[model samples]
Target: MKKVIGWSLGIYLVFGLFIAWYLFLGANTDIPAQLKGSPADPQTFMNERELLLSEEYSKIKNLLFFLSVPFEWLIYTLVLVIGISAKFRDWSKVSAKFSILQTAIYLFWLSLLVEVLSFPLSWISYNVSKTYNITVQSTQSWMKDLLIDFWVNYALMILIVGVLFWLIRRNEKRWWFHAWLLSIPFSMFLMFVQPVIIDPLYNDFFPLTNKELETKILEMADRADIPADHVFEVNMSEKTNSLNAYVTGIGSNSRIVLWDTTLQRLNENEILFIMAHEMGHYVMKHIYIGIAGYLVLTLVGLFIISKFMSFMIRKWGHIFKISSVKDIAVLPVFLLLISVLSFVSDPVSNAVSRHQEKSADLYALEMTDDNKAAVSSFQELSKAGLSQVNPPFLVKIFRYGHPTMLERITYTNEFEKSEE
Candidate 1:
């Protein structure tokens, strides 16, 4: 017990110190004198006040972002070390007549505890966004969304937990393989239903209201062979000032969703470039590829998790107050391992995503043949989102899924110059 506690404290210190070092001292923020005058210049993308606000806002956000992963691990480690999970496991015995219900009860309490413990960070994040005028959502709306998210996440996780324990009981050695097999279709089903079903719970979505703009987008979709029958737009300006567009779902239910904020903030040409970028994802089959990659990662992750979890339980089950692989109390250990693995693998995932996004950017350029619009659109996105055009290397590796704003703009500008 002393050893476990010491190890947990050691990890927390190392993670916290590393995040502090990279965040404060790793990257220079200076903009080159020549680049200072350009719209894509991170330092000059906004007015004086906006620039100041963006700098302060990005700093707070970066601190929160870097801390979030290890913070979760900390929570799980604390929960495990304190025997709270064992309490949850024993408390759920009242529902043991129904094993499924017992499993659900244990998971619900465990997840709820995590959320309650983590709410302060969520509140800090919300207040920061609100202070910077990034989000316009009120306290009531934000809390409502929080509840919705909790329930949605709980619903999915309960299903996963039930399958996991059932597999362990049936065949402890093969559970990981069987669980991985089950996750593939389960993942696909969620993707298929997300845009059509899950998304509407949070925001309204309908065919784009500006008929003329919608027509142009639909035509672009046709040219790209995306088979998108309608362009969808969500009422996002009510909650956020961020400009965005995205591709969501798959097959017949697939959608090209634009934030109404995007339409309000950008010109038709810029909107076309944004929409074309989304269409590029569809044309390139990035969605299918992403799904395949997720499955492969899960397969490997589950295998490793299963082995490590069993070993931890076998070696320290007494210390953990966990009796067996089938004990629900072992979950925190499982979660801790998963979190660490994800943090380690995050850079590789980000690199792959950046490559995909870069490809989508070039595809949009080819489809639109408008370098000016492409470059300007990325600049506008950075300005509106108050994003650092070139964040620190570690920050970019962990948090950014797309190329840096400067990288995208430079690539687009270079493409134009090459053509000329």
Candidate 2:
């Protein structure tokens, strides 16, 4: 018990120090003179209305941001308690005599319970987005999506739990390492199929209808040495008013995707810049980099879970009604550990994403040699998405996957200045 507690504390401290050091002393890009402004004052770059809207949006989002972590932890803990207190293990035994099937059944029920408990939070989020005029989806559509998500999640939980327990049963001593090995190919397989299979299940995707713009985007792709073939457009406006574009898949499946909202809201030059930015992600191999990072993190996370899971089960097994680490009822406890690790390590992951995004921004500027277009595109994006120009430091550290609007705009300004 003491050893487990000590290791837990050590992990927390190490991650905490890493986050602090990275945020405070890491190699951050400099904010250019032209883009610097007090948060209290409206910048000349954005109109007064736009600035006011951005501030209001920032306040709402920041509140949600701060509330989400604790709220999620609380909900997860509650579910764990409820599942254990309810003697889900007994129910699982009655439902299925086979251990693997019992585990799967228990996992599915627990997952469904979590989803039901968490639905209120999801509903609130949607309501808030609607209040801010960000979301365009109707209640019926939203509910439909939620239903789809629940079933999909339930199916996935069963499969994952079944495989995980199988691995544990197969290799009691080295299950974590084996699970990590299995995850590599599984992750790759998901990436390969996601664009072609999973994505289409959620939203409608079509080839870009604008022949002229498609030609222009392909030309830009050609210039970046990315394969020129097709650009896909997703009907995101059906759900949200926000603008977005991305590069997804790998090898033969690789493609550029744009939101229909982005096409409608941004000009030709701005869209070009956005496409260029996504192209940067492809050309820089950020996808592979991200996959490599996930592989390492997964290995470490699984190892940590293995180290302390036995101790945790021994200490609380009677109280929680869980017999052992391999019990179906222990799934929630396993999920709890992984979730805690993920929450603590979020800043590191976000920092890596921000770094990639910054690199992509720079690549876009160089590829197009159009600083004004890049800056304007970012401005439009920030406005459309209601993004904070300069968010609080903690928010930036914890939540931001890309640099704030202020940072990107300033970076472009500096790029232009350096050219001069």
Candidate 3:
């Protein structure tokens, strides 16, 4: 046990120091010339006030983002300690007497504990968003959404944990492989139903009422080789003032959705640029590619968990009151391993997403042939969402799924320059 603890501490310390150095000292922070515009130009995309607000907003948000990682690790560690000390093993044994009811109770309590521990951070995040004028949802509405999120998450956790443990009990050695196989179908199922079942639970969705804008978007979609059909508008104004458009689902369940705020806020040309970018994602099959990437990552993550979990359990099972991998009390330990792995692998994930986004940006430029619109659209998006035009390189590597606003704008300018 001491050896295992020593190994874990050593690895964490080395990794933590390396990450800190990479983020603060080693990463590039340069902005390309194409992205820099003269203040003397009358058509400077971002005004002085916008740039100042964006810088301040990014600083606050980035600080919170970095701080939350350690806070979450501490919270999860505390939960594991408390769960073990609180007789979770005895509780699991008693609950098993009632069949699967024990799994349900154990998961419910565990989830509730995590939620309670996490609520303060969540509250602070919401308040910060409000303070920055990013969100418009009232306190009551936000709380309602939080409650809804909890129950939905609990329900899903119950299903996943129940099935996962059943697999482990059936085949202790290869359960990880089987679990990975099962996750593929489960992920697809969630993707298929989310647009209809899950999303509507939080916000209203309806066919876009603006016939003129709908027609324009459909025309743009047609140019991008996406099927022409209805465009859905979500009532995001009820919750947020930020503008966004997205493509969701797969095959027949697939649809393009625009926020009502985007429709109300952006000009037709800017909206066209945004729609084209989303269509680029669909036409390029990014969603399918993203799913494939997830499949690979999950397989690798599960394999790692399988290899180490047993050794750890053998060494400290008594201390944790967990006797086997099949015990529900081990869930927190499993989650802790997963959380650590996910953080370690975030750079790979973010890099892939950034590549896809960059491709989409280029596709939008080609499809729209409106460099000005494309650049202006990103400028508007950054201003409205309070995005940093020049995010630190470490933030870009770890947190950014798309190129920074400046990067996108610079790419557009470079593309135009090449053509000229």
Reference-based lDDT, residue 69, model 1: 72
Candidate 1, overall lDDT?
A: 0.86
TM-score of each model, in listed order:
0.96, 0.88, 0.89
Q: What is the C-alpha lDDT of each candidate?
A: 0.86, 0.78, 0.80
**What is the overall TM-score of model 3 with all chains considered together?**
0.89
Task: List model 1 lDDT by residue over 1-420, tens digit each.
Answer: 678778887987887787777667766665656666675686555677877776677777998977777779888987887888999988898757788888889989998999998999999999999988999998998999999999999898888888888999999899999999998889989999999889999999999989999999989988877777789999998899999899999889889999999999899999999998998888889999898888888899999999999898888788779989898789898888888888888998899999999999998898888999988888888878888776777778888899988789878877852354
Off by over 4 Å in 1: 32-39, 417-420
The local lDDT score (0 to 100) that residue 237 gets in candidate 1 is 87
* Candidate 3: segments with Cα more than 4 A from true spot: 1-35, 38-43, 83-86, 92-96, 417-420
110-224 per-residue lDDT for model 2 (tens digits): 7677777677768888888898888989999999888888787777777777898888878877999999999998899888988998888889998999999999999988877
Arranged by lDDT with the best first, the candidates are 1, 3, 2
Write the number of the candidate with greater lDDT, choosing between 2 and 3. Answer: 3
Tell me, what's the RMSD of every candidate?
1.9, 5.6, 3.6
